[model samples]
Target: MKKAAMTIALLIAVVATAGIVTGGFSYDPAAAQAAARIKVYSAEMRNYFMSDEIVKSKEEWRKILTQEQYHVLREKGTERAFTGKYATTHDHGIYRCAGCGLDLFRSEDKFESGTGWPSFTQPIAKENVKTEVDRSFFST
Candidate 1:
């Protein structure tokens, strides 16, 4: 199952990369801004499509999230390996996005990938997370 999932993900990455190279997957910031209320899931909601999406400005996010969280979520900074609170956690509950309280992964899907990060085999639902190609300075 893991192999199949990884294969599918790789195939998607390949296709997306091709589209990007061919100028077919250009990003539009306006489109992202327009998609304010995206689908989300929360443990309390118990429904993937019913949870309300939380959209906040950078200042608002800075006020709410911790400094580290602000750096990671807003500035696209990553936490150091093995330093995350949930990296080695064995708790029984749904994992959520730090920026928003959207349920992302089920506890059952969590696995030890030995990468010193909380890894999940899959998300709770396909719509819970949005995947896009990274076009940052470090991206190749």
Candidate 2:
């Protein structure tokens, strides 16, 4: 009985160590492929942003953009639902961050979803905007 218990404990330790070394569990090739695509897309988008010619300081931004825009773009505030001019505009220009002027969504991607906020099927690039998990019930 003592030997059996020792053997079981040793096997458990071995299995746990193997799991840590081999990345916890079975691998999914599809997940790996998706992750790779996301990585490439992210890199490309970042490069695109870095290549753009616009440059401005925080002070310059305050002068150029409205208070709300400044708060949304610079301070990461979410614009109030149904309040952005771009939510209704159908112009052919790129939607930029009004505060930093960083090109965000393309005009072509904008669609009227009637959700009281501007909606887009996709952003121009992943690097153009930053997203965080909004846990506040009112945020969504």
Which digits, one per residue and each the tens of the lDDT, describe model 1 over residues 72-92?
Answer: 878878899999999999999
**Candidate 2 ranges with C-alpha deviation above 4 Å:** 1-64, 138-140
TM-score of each: 0.65, 0.51
**What's the CA error at residue 41 for candidate 1, in Å?**
3.3
**Which prediction has the highest lDDT against the true structure?**
1
Candidate 1's displacement at residue 96, Å, is 1.3
Candidate 1 Cα misplacement greater than 4 A, ranges: 1-34, 43-45, 50-53, 135-140
Q: What is the per-residue lDDT of model 2 for residues 13-129, given as tens digits with 9 covering 90 to 100?
A: 999999999888999898776554322123225454123334578998889888887787677677877887777888886776555445678778889898878889888777556
Candidate 1 vs. true structure, TM-score: 0.65
Write down the worst ten-residue block by lDDT for model 2: 36-45
- Cα lDDT, model 2, residue 140: 54
